[model samples]
Structures are given as structure tokens and as C-alpha cells.
Target: MNRTDLGPQRIVCLTEETTEWLYLLGQQHRIVGISGYTVRPPQARHEKPKVSAFLSAKIDKILALQPDHVFGFSDLQADIAAALVRAGVAVTVFNQRSVDDIVAVLWQVAALVGCTQAAQRWIEAVHAQHAAMRQAVQQRVQRGARRPRVYFEEWDDPPITAIRWVSELIDIAGGEDIFPERACQPLAKDRVLADPLEVVRRAPDIIVGSWCGKKFRPERVAARPGWQDIPAVRQGHLFEVKSADILQPGPAALTDGVAQLHRIVLAWMDGQVAAVLGQGGVAQAGGCHA
Candidate 1:
């Protein structure tokens, strides 16, 4: 088939990221169904039929929609994608685990929807934003501003740490993910911080919680045994970045989520500069150097 002819006219997004992207690309009409967890645009929940959850889907319901294509994410949705493919439905599963992967998948999605030009424009714009952000942070680093150690908790029970994309975004936003080493682990089991005190040992300057679709209770996190000495807990540096913004692995992560992370990190770095200056240290907190 011609590449243009391969594009889907009716689509189902089994994940929030794709649904949110289509909406941003001005192609939401192509999506006949979306995941129940979609809330980025808000209108998607009311406009599209909810047909899937993160790890499960209503196969019959999806078939009834007669979508020409179905979009899903990660190995977690492998079974769902396999079932749909077995049923002779066209399915594309994107396992984007890193910042670059997210950008690559986004461009591929745009091609699938025949909106490559529009998506490319947005991509180029965000890439410029990335350049500007990197420049700003690099300057701060040269000025000896501390890149706050951040513990981004994806899940609180066993305490899953940052994902690859989130970890990269944190660095871009002027914070260092304390567990960057574990960010690329594909499974949550592999990323789990087995010992709760490990987080305390790291002595993170900030504790960011997303909790994967649940409310992040900073108090609950602070109340954990022996966490009082943790710098983040002691100084009230707890924060919540909504899962919808950071966990989606798409536009929201590249834009809104990143912006939020940057604001938090920059403020902390500025405070470090101020504290150092107050103690008669020579590094000032402004200019291209900060």
C-alpha cells in the first residue's frame, strides 16, 4: 500500500499519550476510542468511548468500534496488542522508554495520521525549547549552582523510581534523579527500591511523586519511619507531578511536565546559590553563568 493510503481513518488509542497527541495534532476525529485514563485534554474523556485501561482492554468493545488502527504503549500492553493482532486488527505498539524514543514515536504517530508536517513543526519548536532550557541549566552549573538530588517516586509502595524519559527530563530541568541508574529498567519490579532507607541514604533535596494515576500524599511519604532526617522530608520539598503530565511519554512530558519540573528545580538551584552567597561564598545567582 502507498504510505499515504496506509494511514488510519478510524483509530483507537489504548493509551493516554497517543490520544492526547492526536488532539494536539488536530486529528482527534480519527480517534474513535481512547483509554479511560486519558485526561490531558479532558475533552477526550467526554468525546471518545473509553475502551482500555493501562494493562487491560475490552477486546469485543474495541472490535465493535471497527477502528482501522489501534495504538498502544510498552511491553505491558503486549498481550492486548497480540490479541488484537490475532483478530486481524491492525495494531501498533510503541515501547518508548527514553526521551529520544518518545520523540521518535511521536513523529511515527504523526506519519500514521497524515499529520507529519504539523507534528514536525511542534517537534521542532519543542526541540528549540530543549536547547534553550539546556543552555540555561548549563550556565547555572558553571556558576556552581547545585543540581538538587531528586527522588522521583513513580510508585510509593515498593517505591519504583524514575523512568528513563523522566530521568532525562529531570536533568534537563536542573535536578539529578538519585536513581538514574535504574531508570532504564523495563519492568517496575527491576526498578523497585527494595530498601526504603535507600532513598534516605541518598539524601535527596526533593521528593517528587506521581504514583502512577493515584494521589501522592506527601504527608504519608514524610511519615515513613526514620525519614525525618531525609533532607527532602525535613525541609518539606515534597511535590506531586500528575501522572497524566509526566507518565504519558509524549507531548505532555516534553512540554507541560518538563516545564513543571524545571520550575521546581530552578527554584531550588537558585536557593542554593543564595545560601552559598549568604555564607560569603563568591558565586552570584544570575547572568549567563546562572
Candidate 2:
């Protein structure tokens, strides 16, 4: 019953990304427990016992599971990792804030479970998807289509903008993140908008809200003070992308997340053309169609 040769046969994932990644790599069988927030692969929710949330875990429950290794994400989980280590459980916490870091971490996780080849193949598909999006965006730009100014709201209250990986995905999806500078900040507190009016001043063509785990209320955002003047509000360009899709720093972000973004940007482009044709004037960017 020696386990070292099998590479972490019993694993616990304290976050959605690692759980989803392991499931994608066909290593879900090794997972003994998962974060309660995992929703990427719906089956995971039913198949695995939920042992942890983002910032907290049932340590006693986890211990009972006897996981050989545990995976977590970010410094937010540092305390959880520390406690696990103290109990002699091997813990690897990945702080992947950007797209490249996410890909690299996925590779490392796959390697731990002896699924490097599968991970490589999946990573290649992700790269191909990204390249295809980039090319499509380039083609649009060449055809005189303007990239929309995207304001992705990670949290509505105090208004936290997109993270680094999300910002890069916006660019690849043919939209420029209005708060690119702030998105580079690794910490959510640092990325928070000090002044709510800053979003109004930025004049984004599209506003995407993924308010952590809370449902994004478009009416609430549109009702913000002076937000009616903002182009996104005026044109009704506000949309909600589920937090599990875009906020998770893994395959979901790379695939469904970016794909949704691309569709939004493309729809905006089409709206611009329609507006120009209907008005018989120059095409103005930023208008919600439906």
C-alpha cells in the first residue's frame, strides 16, 4: 500500500481551479475532497465531498479523509496551508494571478498526479483557442472594427476591477480593460476602485460584473450614483459572467470565460455597424443590442 510511487493518490483541493484542472486531466479519481465552490464540472459537486471553502476548511473532516496532498490557491489560503502542514499533510498553494502562471500551475499539478502528457495536450488546446481568438480580433481590427473599452467588475461594492489574467483575456477577446493599471495588482484590496466615479469617467463601452459568489445585479449597478451617465449604463451594456466561469484562475477562465468575452465584444461590433447603417452616419462604438 506504499503511495509515493503513484504520486499523491489521495488529494484534497481547497479551491475550484485545482479541482477543475484535476478533473480535466482525468485525475479526479485521486481527489478525496474539494472546495464547496467548485462548479466547473457539475459532476464534481456530487462526486466529491466538500471539505473547504475559499478562506476556511473543516480541518477535522479533512484529516479524517487522510489526503496525501492538498492543493490550494493564493495567499488568502496561507493560513489553511499552514495548518495542514502542521498536521503533516503536504500542501501546495498556487498563487496564479495571471494567465501564464495559471497554465504553468496546471502543468505542475498535472505532473504531481502523473498526468503530464494529458495536461500538455489540454494546455495545447488552450493555446490554440487563445491564438484563434487573437487572430479573430486582429482580423476585426484590420476591418476597421474598434476594440470596446471593457470595465470588468469583480466586486460591485467598492468596485474591484478585473485581475491580471482577466485583463489579458479581455485584450485577447478584442476589448481593452479600462483599468489595466489596477488589474495588475495581485491583491483585491489594491485593485479596488478608490472612487466609484472613476468608472463613470473611464466611459467603458462594456461593463461585466462577476461579484465573487454573489449574483451580479445589473439594476443595482445601473442605479449607482451618476452611473446613468456612463456609456455602459446608458447603452445598457451591463452583463454578468458567473464568478465560477471567469474568476477561477484555470481552464474555465481560459475557455468559457474568454469565449463569453469574445462573443460580447463581437456583438458590440455588430451593434456598431447596425447603428451606423440605421443612422446613415459614422459608426459609434458601444451599444447593447439585446
Candidate 3:
């Protein structure tokens, strides 16, 4: 189908990533609705009517829009997808679980919107950046340097580790995630450290918190009992990465989030080396507290 004649003319995106991706690919004209939580591109939240939220939607309002296609993600959005399907509205739900899955979904969405060439170009550019970053990380790893043990907290109520894509980026950035094996789990509770004290046990060299949609409070994290004993806290290695930058299942995660992870890890690793060599006091790694 030609871009002008693509099947979907009026689309509702139930997630931020897809909405942002569509806009980036110059297909925003087709979008009629978006999630209320979308803030990546900013203008989307202002221009498009919000018909849905993360795991809920106003079915009547969405149906009223008469969208030709509705885009959603994961089992979290399964109910919304079912409701639209029952209403005889076409919907495509992407259940991407990893970084690679996210990239594939980008291509698939572009194809669905008849913007395959645009998607390819965008993908190539991201891939080039990823390649360069990966090489730089590998070089740092090969220089007889110890990879920092990173603890990525996705939530604090029960303490959750990083998701698959975040974990992958940590590895690519030359750091080993504390809960590397649990990276693929979807729910935060599943990745939670049952003991809460396990974080102390792991002795992570760096701590990065995203805290989903809320602003991360380093002081709160540092005040946890026994947490002060952890190397990351004692050495001031705690950092906050915003959810939009690292947790989004889209190009922003791969580009902005991964790059942030790389920079943080690199700085941490460099600090450790510098301290061991008696060059100066421990290096302080910076983070976006937003």
C-alpha cells in the first residue's frame, strides 16, 4: 500500500512508544488518539486526544473516535485490545519482550503504516549508533578493567530489577546487572528481591533507579536500612535514570537510555580504576534525578 493509501487512516495508540515512533516517521497525520501518559514527544499529548492509559481505556470514547487501527502493547493492554476487537475495530497488539523485539515491532508498525523505507532508514541510523557504542564498551571491557556490578531499581515499594532491554543495555555498556537472569520477566514483582536485603548481599558497585513514572529520590534510596552499607551508596554511585529514557520499549530506550547507561557505567568503571591506582578521590558519577 502506498503511504497515502495505507489501510489505517485514523489510528489510536494505546502506548507512548508507538505514538512517538509514528510521529518520528512522519506518520502523525494518521494518528487520532493517544495514551494520556504519553510525554516523549510532548506535542502528541497536546495535539491528540487521550483515549487510553497504561492498562485502562475509555472504551466508549475510543469507539467514538472510529479509529481504523488501534495499537497496543503486551498483556497489560490485552483487555483494551479485546474490547476494540469485539467492537469490530481492527487492532494490532505488539507483545515485545526484549530490545530486539522492540526493534522488530518498529519495522512491523512501519510496514503496517506503509512507511517501510522510513523505518529502515531510522533503524539503520540507530543501528549505526548502537554499533559504535557497543565497540567502545567492548574496548573498555578489554582493557583489564573490572565490570561494575549494577543494581537497576525499577520500583521501590518492593524493589524491582531492570527489564530485559535495560539489562541488555547494562551488559552492552560494560556492566553486569545484579539480577541478570531475571531480566526477561515482565512483572516488577517477579524481579523483586524477596529478601530486600539481597541488594546488600550483592554489593553492587553502582545503583541506578528509574522508579517507573515517579521522580527517583536518592535520599530515600540511601536511607533504607542496611542499604547504606552497600558499596554504591557508600561510594556515592547511586544514579537516577528517568523512566522515559530507559523504560520505554521504543527507539528512545535504545538510543537515549542505552547511551545514558553506557556513560554511567563507563564513569563508574573509570572511577573504580582511578581509585585503585591512587590517582585521586573516588570519581563521582552523575545522573538525571528526573
Candidate 4:
């Protein structure tokens, strides 16, 4: 008997994004193992045996799987990649910190799994959806609305802001990320909010909490001392977007995540317009949040 090799028959994904992408591209059958954190397609958790976590994996168990290729994400996973490499296992680690890189990763992974055509079609659809959403926001601006000020809380302990892709998505969703500079930094330490008062000072109209896999408790955020005057807290604009929907850096973040963001930001814009009309301020520039 002879076995025909289609590219990378036995694949292990050390991150949720790649696992989710492969499943989306109809290449899930090639996956031999997946990260325990994958929840985008909840069925993945049940169908695939959990073999890895975000920062660690069962190395011996992974070796036992005999994967021909292992895909990981970011410098955070460099140690795992290195260990696998030392054992002569093929490894590819991607550092996709921004929206563009994530879109590109989709195509690259699909190509490896011999599904480039399907992947390209899906990618084009996603891009089209993004463009349509941006256009809708642009129309809103033309009708006397401004982008909302958005603060995406990636972590709550020290109040880390958005990551690169989330920042870009905020712009597309008719909101301006308050901490755009922080998003450029790949490491969370660099993006940490050193001064909690900085958030109040920025005066965001909307607060989106993802909180890195934990339940986002907006009440806790509102209860922070001196946060009473913050516009988002005062106006009851704090909202929670689950990490699985917004932080994966792949289709989930680019499509569903951004859509949710657009809805939230647009609603805020509507509220701003209503407030101006109620005050009889002539609705000049609709808040000019950015």
C-alpha cells in the first residue's frame, strides 16, 4: 500500500487563530492537535484533543502525536517553537500583530494546507465585508456624526489597551482607539496603562472590555475610584466583548469582532447626536471624538 502526501498531513496548531482558520478553510481533518484555548468554533474543542495552552503545551504528548508541522503565533510562543525545532519537528511561528498580517496569515496557512483557492475566496469576502462596514461609518460621518472614542481593555489588572488588530478594527468600526500608540507594541507589558488616571483623562465615550478570556465585569471598572466622572462610566457605556470574539487576531477578530464593535460605536454616535439635539446645540460636528 502507498500513501499519497497532500501537504502536511499531520498538523498541530499551538494557537487558536490557526486552528480556527484551518477549520474555516475546511482543512480541519489535517489537524492532529489544537490549543485548549480555541473557542471560536466551540465544536473544535470537542472534535480535537486539547494539546496546548497559550503559553505552554504538553511537549511529550505533542511528540507522541507525530505531527509533521506545528503552527504557532507570536514571540510569546517562541520557546515552544524552539523546543519543537530542537527535536527536529517542523515549526512555523507567525508574529501577526496587525489586521493586515492576520489577513495575510489566513492565506499563507491555507496555502500550506493546499486550500489556497478556498482561503482566497473567504479572505476576499472578509475584506469586502470590512469595506462595506467602513463605508457605512463614512456615510454616518457625512450625516453629521463623528467617530466615538473607544478604549478597549485587553487586560484589567494594569488596564492594558488594544492590540494592533483591535486598534485598526476600532477605526474601521467608527471609533478611535484612545491608546493607538500602545497597540503598536507587540508585548502586553509595553501596552500596559501605567497611569490609571490616563483613561479618565482621555475621556472615552465607549469602553470595551475583553479582559483576556475572563468575564468582563463592567461594574468593577465603573467602581474604580475617581472613575465616576469618566464619560463612559457616567453614561453607562461600558460593554463586554468576549475574548474569543475579539482577541484571536484571525477571522473572529476581523469579521465578527469588528462587526460587534461597529454596532457599539455607531450606537454611541447616535446617542451623541441625540444629546446635541436635546441641548439645542445645532449638532455641530457631532462631538468630534477623534
Candidate 2 has a TM-score of: 0.90
lDDT of 1: 0.81
* Model 2 misplaced regions, further than 4 Å: 1-5, 272-290
For each candidate, what TM-score against the reference?
A: 0.89, 0.90, 0.90, 0.90
Q: Write the per-residue lDDT of candidate 3 for residues 75-106, one digit (tens) a residue.
A: 87888899999999999998776878989999
Q: Write model 1 residue lDDT over 63-131, tens digit each, in one string.
A: 999988999887788999999999999999998888899899999998887777788789999989988
**Candidate 1 residue runs with Cα over 4 Å from true position:** 1-6, 272-290
At residue 35, what lDDT does model 3 achieve? 86
lDDT of 1 at 194: 82
lDDT of 2 by residue, 157-225 (tens): 788888999999999888999999987788888988889999999999888887776767778999999
RMSD of each: 7.8, 6.9, 5.2, 7.6
TM-score of 4: 0.90
Q: What are the per-residue Cα lDDT tens digits for candidate 4 across 39-120?
A: 7577888988788888889988899999999998877788999999999899999888888998888878877877877887
Model 4 scores a C-alpha lDDT of: 0.80
Q: Model 3: runs farther than 4 Å from truth?
A: 1-4, 272-290
Q: What lDDT score goes with residue 287 in model 1?
A: 9
